[model samples]
Target: AVNLAIAFAMQGHENKVGLLDADLHGPCVPTMLGMQDQKLKVGPIGAFPALGPLGVKVVSMAFVLAGKEVPVVWRGPLKMRAIEQFLSEIAWGELDFLLIDLPPGTGDEPLSVLKLLPEMDGVIIVTIPSEVSQNVVGKAITFAKQLNVPVIGIVENMSGFVCPDCGKETHIFMKGGGKKIAQEYSVPFLGSIPLDPRVCEASDMGHPFIMEYSDSPASKAFMIIVKKIKAFISERQS
Candidate 1:
């Protein structure tokens, strides 16, 4: 989701974007952006975010860890503090959009980010087209509403898989769960992303799938979602 947002923002040269990997327990932005070995540099004021493809500024715990194998065994308070610092201390300069990739579920990290960035534009909830995911995502929506944080939309990821050999589409996790949730919750249904092997392969190779596989169905779906997000933002601003 973060990568897709960055790629969409990078489509035009006018927008300045940044991604904050607030999922400290399993920070993957650095790895996904191919900066696993890199470290965040401390400037005079605060730590500097690493530059990524299309000039997207990125900050993640993966950059701070000595290695990928090193585990983040911090407690709740510690995790909250780290999240606070990531928001307050990172040198995120003049960003038009800053996408915070919160850890899954309504957990400590998500709460900390909401508390810290109270004026967040909104959240884009990502879920699979499954009943279990639908139930859990409902809790997320309630949590956001309780905090008075708007939900921009919901994205149903891995909605289906298309066979490369025969070009047949399979509803791997079952379909319409995302839109059903959106309708029940009264939030906008952004779009559904079909499962594509290239998405996984791109992540493994430290590349943005939207950029590398622009012609794929998954990428096309992602772009449609991005357009909806932009429209939401514009509507809010207007």
Candidate 2:
């Protein structure tokens, strides 16, 4: 999701993007973006998101936590309130796209965000190429449909692993599950991102992999997915 946000921001022309880390239990977006220690600036109006790479505005609970080791152990109601504040209290300013990264599941965090943003463009479900992961995609699609939220599509991450030396692709988690499920549910298959070691390194260093390794297969896949997402949104608007 962080990579996708970066992809949209790095699209050359002036495109304003804001990423809300709605995954309350594990707000790793800040850490992955290399701003875990950064805090949101508050003024009389509201709080301002931290400026991330490629000028993407980012908001996450990790910024307000006492430390990296701190955990958000709150009930559902508390979490719902926090999300409400995140949406209403943050001065997101004007944005071309505001991507909310929800935790995996049809749980409270996603439910709250969906209810709050009834006019949301859509929800993009990310999954790995495994039966276990694909099974959850069905539930997610149903969840969005039940709530009257559009399912933008499905993104298959860690689809396959390419050996650095041999350049051979290995189906570590079994391939084509994403497209299969997308076909099963009649949703668009945005693209598949192959597993790359550099992605992990970039994440740890808080770098946007799509920018740093734009030529890599995974990065290329991200670009394709971003284009599809943009087209989807454009079509809906038209």
Candidate 3:
């Protein structure tokens, strides 16, 4: 989800984007964006986010940890305080959009960020096409609605897999769960992203899949969803 958001923000030269990795327990933005070894600089005001590709500023717990194996074993209050600091102390300058990547489920981290950014545009729920994912994602939607945060839409990741040899599309996790959930909840079904192995390869290499494999099915689906997100934002503003 974070990678896709970065790709969407980098689509246009005028788009200034920032990404906050609020998944305190398992922050992956630093590693995925290839800034794991980079540390945040303490300036006059606060910590500055590391510069990423396309000039996307990013902040993650991975940047603060002494080592990759370091663990964050704190209570709810500590976690909430950390999130607050990330929002208030991080030097996130003017941005067209700031995407906060929350840990999955309606947990303390996600709730804290939502409360801190009440005026946030909305949330783009990402889930795989499965009964379990659909069930858990339902709670996510409810959480956002209860907090008065609009749900932008749902993006079904790993919706299906395309065979490399036969060129056949396989329903690896079964299909249509995302759209079904959207319909049942009366929310928008943005689009579906097929399960492409190249996505994993790109992540392991610290490269954005959309940039490396723009011709892949998953990348194509991602751009389609990105368009829907922009349209949704425009409609809301208008």
Pick the TM-score winner.
2
Candidate with best lDDT: 2
* Residue 55 local lDDT, model 2: 82
- Could you give the candidate ranking by lDDT, starting with the highest? 2, 1, 3
Model 1 pairs whose backbones collide: none
TM-score: the better of candidates 2 and 3: 2
- Candidate lDDT values, in order: 0.85, 0.91, 0.85
Tens-digit lDDT track for model 1 on 1-238? 5556566665573247888898898888776777777899999999988888788888889888888899999988999999888888988887877888988899999998888788888999999998988879999999999988899999999899888899888998999999999999999999998898888888888888888878888888887887788889889989
Instruction: Please write out the lDDT profile of model 3 over residues 1-238, one tens digit for every residue.
Output: 5567666665783247888898898988877777789998899989998888788888888888899999999988999999899889988888877888888899899899888889888998988888878889999999999999999999888888878999898899998999999998999999998888877777877887887877777778888887888889889999
lDDT comparison, 2 vs 3, better candidate: 2
Assess candidate 3 and give its lDDT: 0.85
Candidate 2 deviant stretches above 4 angstroms: 12-15
TM-score quality measure for candidate 3: 0.96
Which scores better on TM-score, 1 or 2? 2
Better of 1 and 2 by lDDT: 2
- Each candidate's clash count: 0, 0, 0
Off by over 4 Å in 1: 13-15
- Over 140-222, each residue of candidate 2 has an lDDT whose tens digit, in order, gives 99999999998889999888987889988899989888999999999999999999999999999988888899999999999
